[model samples]
Target: MQGALRFGARLVAILVLLAVLYSAAALSFALSPVSGRPQQADGEPLVYVCTSLAHADIVMPSRDPLIDWSTHFPAVTPPGLPAGAYLAFGWGDLRFFREVPTWADVRPSIALSALAGVNDTALRVIAINPPANDPDCRALRVDRAGRQALIDYIRATLADETQSRPVEQAHLEAYYLARGRYSPLRTCNQWVADALAAAGLPHALFAPFSFSITWPLEKPPLLPGKS
Candidate 1:
């Protein structure tokens, strides 16, 4: 029984060490600023960065009907989204797309595989019509150059280099294969933070969790007519 006890202790120590290293790396990459603050130019677009407890996504400015997201993405965007709906984008492990059809399908092994970056990646898109004053969302205004750079970075995340456009798959509605190496170190939270930094918006140097990314947006409410 002493042998069993020693093995268990060793396992715990290894796990603890991994946790510390992951935390350190996540903070190091996530927090570093991309560049100086962006200057707002004429006709700069305004976008929103939103997050949930486990994931982070971008709510694109989709109020304009002329710009059909389908043309750009060509994927299964669920029908019946409101005319003024915003397109939300999220990136995650490829195994997560194939295996975890629902949260119930998640297992410890699968989660670990994903966190270790052994799996591929996918991008999920959805349409949303959030309330005008969403406390959970933060607006980021980006100049033309910054906005273009962010868009290019987003498009480059597609997994298929040959496919100039997105390859729509039937089984997973509103999701497409994405390019990028995702691990515990490069998590969804970090992706959102990186995207914001690319857009030249004010952002944290590092964000490992949804709260870490959204904390800057969630300030105490202001009184009516108060600055």
Candidate 2:
């Protein structure tokens, strides 16, 4: 009986060894770069550049609605523009509020913002291509020229003294607008893309599925839907 017990113990040890080997193999396969593609997260269908005004406080609605439009109108309207123009121009505030914080956090908002101010939908359509799962997908970075232009535009817009009771107030207004429009989902790489586009630099958006990955992965395929 002792001998039989020893044999049973040996059998159990072998099974355990085999199981360990199998588990190790499975783990290696899963982690291997060539094994499968990385899974794609749900993301926007396209990439876009955000407008400068979208980030300003003047454009964004205040927490207190009563104090917003009526109280802020004198401060919000640009000099030399009619009240109707302010209303129309202020629509950008909504887009800013809705924007996601970063490209990884919400790609569609980035795409839409990037496409803003462009009248051609076809061009906008071309700017939305970037793989959701690609580590390099967030690499879009803004260029120096674009950055300077944005800064200059902000400076000019805020320079009008009549727009505010004080020059500082105008500055604060611009600051709030920019802050509100700032996208968290936007990556440095994406900013480069946006900045370039903002400066009239040319680029194209590709289909996300076009990216080739060696690993066995799952990316949510794009489907037809309203933007």
Candidate 3:
């Protein structure tokens, strides 16, 4: 019994150590000089970087009628968004996004697979009018080229065939399309960071969490009613 107890204690210690190390590495990357660039303040053609409690998304205007979002992701606007909708793009674990509508739907296997890097990647898209600036979301401006590059990156993430597309979700009124694979190291948050970097924006070298991805957008994060 004592031997078993010792073994359990050792396991706990190892887990705690791993968690600490992970946190330290993430923070180091977050505070690095590379991620310190402030969001571009140039007006118009602004793009929003939104985040929820556990996820991050890029919100951009639907300026080009040629690339109509409704035609591609019709689920976003069933009755047709006449005024057009601001497109929000997010990436996550394929199975988790399909099965887990909210955090409440999380399962042990889902969590473990995402953390173990054994999961496939999927994209989540939503089209809303005027875009949302809720407590969880913050807007950032991007140049025309930057926005186009970001869109290109998203398109590249999607497989070249329709067979890769997953079934649309009825809950969030969003579509889940198969894209890159996911792992502990290549999490959705990391993808967001990479997207920002690919677009010539400043972002953490390894943003593993939503907050880390959102933090660099504003220095000394603005508290409620303070800004």
Candidate 4:
């Protein structure tokens, strides 16, 4: 019994050390910014980057001169979405999203499967009318070229016929089969960071957490006449 107790204590200490190392690495990489090319050229369009406690999402206008999101995402919009709402895109492990609708529902097996790097992933798209003063939302101005690059990067993640396998979830979100592997290293927030870099937008060198992407962004400006 004494030997078993000693082994358990050792295991706990090892886990604590690993957690500390991971936090240090995450913070270090997040602080290292990857400077992007000048994106404030004339006529640049605005896109929003939003974050929750654990996830980050890129929000784009539903209908833009470059593309109509509805055409690409034909799944029924969540109820209460207006005619021209914005679309927020996110990526995560398929089982994690389907089984764990809320953090309260997170299971050890599901979490382990996601971190194990052997699970399928999915893309989450939600229609929302984002508020101007939300601290979690920030606006980024990207030129037409940059916007196109971002679009291409997102499209590349869609699995074949992803639309047919849509999994509607609460919070007015839909999940589509996505092409990618989720692991401890490649988290959803990191996916957002990668997408920003793919579009030549300023991004974190490495983002394993939501704050890594959201911390550097500026809050969106208010619309005309609205305080």
Candidate 5:
């Protein structure tokens, strides 16, 4: 019994050490210079990166002159959306997303399953207004070509471009089946970074955490009367 207890303690210590090392590596990468140069994306044709500390979402205009997002996301019109609402796209583990809306809801088994890349993934789309002055949002300039590349990258991650069923949920959000698997290496934040890199926009070398991707952008302060 004593030997078993010692073995368990050692295992716990090893896990803790691993977690610390991972965090340090992530921080180092986040502080390092980004990998790519900014495309010819000047002040116009802006896109936003919204972060919830733990996750990241790519926010784009619902409709533009070159692309009609509604046609691609047919069943994604949530209520109270204005005429020209924006859409926030997030890719994550299906079960983790559906079950754990917040960190408090995370369970060890579910987290392990997601990290193991054993379960499928989904894309969560939220129709929102322009996140102006919101601290969680940071804008990025993308020219027409860069915008098209970003859109193409996002579309390729969809399980079906023609038809998709929205996951039944109470929030004004739609979740669709996604093409990629969710693992420790390809986290949701990493997906956002990859999308940016695909468009030749500024992005991190390794973005396993939200800050790793958002590190280069400026974060506005929280609005008055808001958290």
Candidate 6:
């Protein structure tokens, strides 16, 4: 009986040691931070990793259709305005379209939609995009020449600005409405590629689906490529 008791105790001790080692390793991994670009699944590049809140904030702006509502909706006058008058008068004074649209605009809606459907307790929405290797393909890298052109356009549009506030309000309303919806994380690769094409930059928007593993325990073959 004493021998059996000793054996049981030894087994317990071994189990305890294993548990401790496993716990230590797990803690180390959890505490460590990942660096550099996320690995591509098929061909898509991962650009940003952030919480749903952060993602939401970035995407709301891009989905906004920069339209001059006063010009577009000349027939529909603002409420409480006279027949000959307009709503949001003098709105064109402020500069609009200072920055180009990006994927950040639609991230919030995406997060909200995903959270609504899935169990967000253990899972996270991972967004992937194409690599921003070329200067013309990056919003941040809107070159001096491009910046000048954009500014010139804005100045020209706003120069004879008659209905500034109404147009601005329309944009603001659109932004708020989009914010209320599920704005998915935009693949900046596509946005940049589009911008490049519009600007006559030599680059193509490649829409390839891919996956990545943010955790170390995740084995290889992280994500399958989808073209």
Number of the predicted model whose lDDT against the real structure is largest: 5
Residue-by-residue lDDT tens digits, candidate 1, 119-171? 77887766667534786677765666666766666667677634534434552
Runs in model 3 deviating more than 4 A are 33-43, 64-67, 77-79, 161-166, 220-227
lDDT string, candidate 2, 1-227, tens digits:
99999999999999899768754543443334232112122331222232231221111122122222323334444454333221211112223223444444556654556445321111000111123344432222223343344333333333242343421133113212221222222322223233333333332121111111111123222233512
Worst 10 residues of 3 by lDDT: 33-42
Model 2: lDDT equals 0.30
Q: Give the TM-score (vs. native) of candidate 2.
A: 0.19
Global lDDT of model 5 = 0.80
60-84 per-residue lDDT for model 4 (tens digits): 8777678877777766353445766
- How would you order the candidates by TM-score, starting with the best? 5, 4, 3, 1, 6, 2
- Candidate 5 lDDT tens digits, 63-85: 86668787777666644457677
**How close is every model to the real structure, measured as TM-score?**
0.74, 0.19, 0.82, 0.85, 0.87, 0.20
User: Best candidate per TM-score, number?
Assistant: 5
Q: Residue pairs in steric clash, candidate 1?
A: 30-205, 30-206, 31-205, 31-206, 94-120
The C-alpha stretches of model 5 lying farther than 4 A from their native spots are 78-81, 169-171, 218-227
- Measured over all alpha carbons after superposition, the RMSD of each candidate to the real structure, in angstroms, is 5.3, 20.5, 5.0, 5.2, 6.1, 18.6
Every candidate's lDDT: 0.66, 0.30, 0.70, 0.79, 0.80, 0.27
Which consecutive 10 residues in model 5 have the weakest lDDT in total? Answer: 216-225
Pick by lDDT: 3 or 6, better one: 3
Q: Residue 23, candidate 5: how far off, in angstroms?
A: 1.1
- Candidate 6 lDDT by residue in tens digits, 1-227: 99999999999999899768755643453334132122322332112211121111111111112332334233333333232221111111011111213444445544444435331111011112222342212222233343333223322333233433322233223110011111122222222222323322233233111111123212222232421
| Residue 38, candidate 4: C-alpha displacement in angstroms | 0.9
Clashing pairs in 4: none
- The residue ranges of model 6 lying beyond 4 angstroms of the native Cα positions read 38-227
- Candidate 3 is scored at a TM of 0.82
Window of ten residues with lowest summed lDDT in model 4: 216-225
The TM-score measured for candidate 4 stands at 0.85
The better-scoring model by lDDT among 3 and 4 is 4
